[model samples]
Target: MTRTIARLALAAAGLALLPGLAQAQKNAPHNDIAAQAEQVFRSSFRADNPKYWMTRLDQDEAMRLCSQYRDNPPPKMRAQIEKAQMATIRYPVEGKLIGDWKEGEKLAAVGTGGHIGFIQPDPPGRLRGGNCYACHQLAKKEVAYGTIGPSLQHFGKLRGNSDEIIKYTYDKIYNSNAFSACTNMPRFGLHSWLTPEQISHIVAFLVDPESPVNKD
Candidate 1:
């Protein structure tokens, strides 16, 4: 009689759990939660921040698609993004793809003036830089470097400073997604953060034989 009662109790417990299990299965996350999370994320930032800083949060087409696809879009969508971004690349009026590598060295090393700060945002008209060392190993002497992107220490040494190399390096700096969609590399020239001439200097930094990236 006790065994029969215990079996009945177990059956009752199982029956009670069925509704909760069903609800759990049906409550999978979707748009509502995503919207809420995004709202919470936005609220974390200061609303009084400068327009330039606030605007950075707004997503462009590529950025929107990248987030939707989790930064791993299929080939068709990836190609579409690259094509659209490539159209935005501009060349200097003088059509120079290479500039003074010396200047590029300065830009690549300086990581200040980022726009992410709120209470103490960068002062207006402050100079920004590629902050390349934040993501890439540019020169061998720089022991402290990020590994998010490949080490470019021997970039020019490995890839000769040919016209093709110069053009590719310049375009990549101007708009990295033009070559690799949803890339972590910033679209320096595309967003006017860096001018075409500035990009050309970075190109020289990457492909110039005399640049520390190559020689040192």
Candidate 2:
């Protein structure tokens, strides 16, 4: 009878401690939670090129700040972040910021690259693409487009192809955070996911009068 009572007391003690453990987890700092999540994410993935995947996990200053602000940084901080990101933008050497819209159109439809799974690294020579259609609707004929971002249909018609507009568009694509801090748009150029020439092509797709983005 004494042994049974002892076991019952121990069970009660363990049950009493459960709430405190739960509360501790609930009160853990955001960084600690993120660390735990990162650990789990890293353990879940198996990559032959671990360094490629591991480097992706490391966040830059802008990404870190965006996370801290929950993608809504205050006005002053927003300006600071924008300025910092703007400084990172590198224009082309030839002083031309436009490329073939045809290439851009192809790139927009492609949603492959940086993919890792049980299959590991992608096949060789599979070029990375902007995958722009995943977010913004550029071409009016595209039946499938995500609404996470505003529709960019008639983009060139709305915004005239002035030098200022062209530069603004180029910079925005190079590092979207340069224009809007904590934006969901990926910093394509900042991360080298796309080269300056490739970004220029995307800009052309958006601003060129003959591009599908502006076509009726």
Candidate 3:
């Protein structure tokens, strides 16, 4: 009986090895694997309503390329990816990319919006916040803050208010990925996560002399 049991275990291990050997012999294409994964994903989540959101699962040109290379493409690939992304960014047509710092401070702290799958959603008057403090240390007064990114306690003081500096700051806040490909920072303007006016305010928050970010 013990001999029979050992034979059965050996047979099971051989069965597993057969599949591994077969897979090694017949390698699946990357696109085929991705398509299979997407099918599995769609089957799991296709029941939900809001068909518009479902379309988001589809990848765009940049997203497809980014995923194809797992966000660490070669230097040449990185530059090509950045150039594709940079073409999508549109600067403010008015040529004035600054707004009220006070309002900007309030918006940066609110942190609400982008919630779905709810029955009776939030009221119409909800204000979305940047929650920049969640990933960055903004001011000296804010005792509790995250440090995923660099601190901006004295952003303006450290980087004086020059037109070029102001433009760079505004553009950085608009689409961080344009500057650094695959950056963890969200593309606030690219995704319409924040409006141009709101972004300008964020720029002001970082560049304005009177803002808390620059005050101390």
Candidate 4:
């Protein structure tokens, strides 16, 4: 009878622990995989630009939060992220939010910058490009465009060229996460990938009616 009673108590204890065990199993695999993947990535690449490449591995608060939520943070967290990112945007000193659409078009199309491979770094004097077409359909003439981002074919036509719209466009390009937290778009201005002047031009490319992006 004692043996049977002990067995019953053991079963009840196991049942009580099931919830904790299940929760641990659910969480541990994701962490384990992430750690393993990070290790592999760190080991795979030789430090071409040790300072630059190593910094990429380090996650800031925004990056860490985004990863924690899998790019879909809760509304409160999203708002917090947006608020923080919005504070980082820097506008041009000349107070011009728009520039030449032609220059903008060139910036959008040219996609070479900050490339690192094996032991090689990007050659100096190579102007950086937004490579916008890789993720967005801008000009109608570009036959090959990626669909990762929304089609911007009629961006200017639809939104029109208002002061508010222009500012929003420039800010968005500068720090996309400022508007939409955990967005896939790169923070061009925040990272210095594109200068404020370059971003202003790109804004013109999207908002200029004469630009091929808005033309049918």
Candidate 5:
């Protein structure tokens, strides 16, 4: 038991050390590279912009953890991180998790919010989108969708409308990290990338028989 415990500790230590060793072998100072990158990145932005936007370049706890593990944290740590993330999800207040799929279709198609050219964000009233097409193929009709995520065409046909499945899909879109510790999926809901109503509508698009997603 003692030997096994020692071996596990050494393995964990080695995993932690690996990235640093690689960084050092390049004869580069860690903070210097990071600071230089940040300087270059910030220089691209206008100084008149909101300070909060600049703050986003800094890492939060979750971002730091994922970076430390290279997005492959150990099983135990991953579960802990996921549990913490799951707690962040806020369900709808009106108990309405489904909305009009027509609205959702529009939301899914809207891709103008993030990191766009010269213009800064309009005040809070600006419409945001799921931008699902950027990483997911939603329907056969949309010939220009991305392939980063699994094809969601015929999603309803394959996965029936059950409370459990609906809830899982909702939560997955809300905070994908809850389902996949190192998922490439963005934390849409957790990051306010989408609202509950918006998410519900997207869910409707995925599950509604009359939605184009199902027809395609």
Candidate 6:
């Protein structure tokens, strides 16, 4: 009840500032407003929403640096971030850098799991897939793929699944920030969003000669 009242008051105060927002903002201390904004944000979430001790709201070193630079840090800082992120990557135990593309294809298409909110809580044992197609085009058949990232059709045909390419593909999938700091691509393995074996499977889906990503 108190948090709800505070949020409402904050909203009202914000509206009251609209008439002379320019002058008021000029006079307002940024730190004060920032603190108030943070309170409002915190108050907006339901108590249960932040439960389960999830670290989703917490920022790690890389996330902090990325946010500090607005995702475009200096070249030197970018290199530092990438190197640090690279050190966090772990390979599979059996020395396998590629796995079944069929599994990878399923993972790429699945965008389910890790859901939040009281009405949207994920069910037990629900698979948390990488949902690669959400950001990049893999097979020519999935006409609904997003364009946030470059299309990867014919990836193996163009790059050829060489030993170096296999390693590169695995490393990139495990932790894309190792190659490019602040990249939109998630650090699947580093964050444990996907297992090392899962990443290897994704690598195969992109580099296997017979995979639809190449054949199609």
- Give each model's whole-structure lDDT: 0.85, 0.83, 0.75, 0.87, 0.79, 0.84
TM-scores vs. true structure, each candidate: 0.79, 0.78, 0.78, 0.80, 0.74, 0.80
lDDT of 6 by residue, 168-206 (tens): 999988899999999899889988889999988888999
Tell me the deviation in Å of residue 180 in model 4. 1.0
What's the distance in Å from true for residue 43, model 1? 5.3
Q: What is the C-alpha RMSD of each candidate to the true structure, in Å?
A: 16.5, 15.3, 15.8, 12.6, 7.6, 12.6
Q: Across residues 136-167, which tens digit of lDDT does each residue of candidate 2 receive? A: 89898996988888898988889988889899
In terms of lDDT, the poorest run of 10 residues in model 3 is 20-29
1-216 per-residue lDDT for model 4 (tens digits): 999999999999779756644553365437777778879977876655568767877887678768867888767667877988999999999989999999999999988878865656678788889999999999888978888889999899999999999999999999999999999999999999999999999999999999998887
Which 10 successive residues of model 5 have the least lDDT summed? 20-29
TM-score of 5: 0.74
* lDDT per residue as tens, model 1, 1-216: 999999999999779756644553354336577678879888888667768777888889888767766777767667767988999999999999999999999999878776567456678777899999998998888888999998999898998989998888988988999999998888999898888998889888889999999998
- Candidate topping lDDT: 4
Q: Model 5 over residues 90-198: C-alpha lDDT tens digits?
A: 8888977777889888888887666633456555556778888988888778888988889899888789878777788889889998888878888989888898889
lDDT of 3 by residue, 111-143 (tens): 687655546655666777788888888767886
C-alpha RMSD of candidate 5: 7.6
Candidate 3 has which clashing residue pairs, if any?
Answer: 111-129
4 or 5, greater by lDDT: 4
Give me the runs in candidate 6 sitting further than 4 Å from their true place: 1-43, 48-54
Per-residue lDDT of 54 in model 6: 46
Instruction: Estimate candidate 6's RMSD in Å.
Output: 12.6
